[model samples]
Target: MDIFEKVKEIVSEKLHISPERITLESNFKKDFEADSIDLFELVMTMEEAFDVELDDDAVVGIETVADVVHYLQEKM
Candidate 1:
């Protein structure tokens, strides 16, 4: 799957939301009501699934689903 598809899968599974609800414009906090812990778990799960290390500082700017996809695409 592509980066967006992969990210959508991970976020949907972690947040227990419908994959259809997760779009490029979807915000983790505003759209999904994700707390810090939820974001953390999502990041960690993405790291494991994508086989990459996400720096704490780097994760700060990741507010939307597209942000995560872009970040992971760059890293991978």
Candidate 2:
């Protein structure tokens, strides 16, 4: 799968949401009810899945799945 699909899968698994419900417009707080720990776990999960450690700047700016995809694509 492509980066976007992989990201969606990660988010879906982490957040316990359907892939259809996760969109570019989906907000983690407002839409998914994800708390701070959820985001933290997501970061660690993404790091494991992609086999890359995130820097402070990359971790701080990720506000959406698209941001994660862009960050991973850049790193890869």
Candidate topping TM-score: 1
Task: Please give each candidate's TM-score.
Answer: 0.97, 0.88
Off by over 4 Å in 1: none
RMSD of each: 0.6, 1.2
lDDT of 1: 0.94
Residue-wise C-alpha lDDT for candidate 2, range 1-76, written one tens digit per residue: 8878888998999999999988866777778998889989988988898988888777877787777888999888
Count clashing residue pairs per candidate.
Answer: 0, 0
Q: What lDDT is reached at residue 24 by model 1?
A: 99
| Residue 19 displacement in candidate 2 (angstroms) | 0.7
- In Å, residue 48's CA in model 1 sits off its true spot by 0.3
Candidate 1 lDDT by residue in tens digits, 3-76? 99989999989999999888999999999999999999999999999999998999998999989988998898
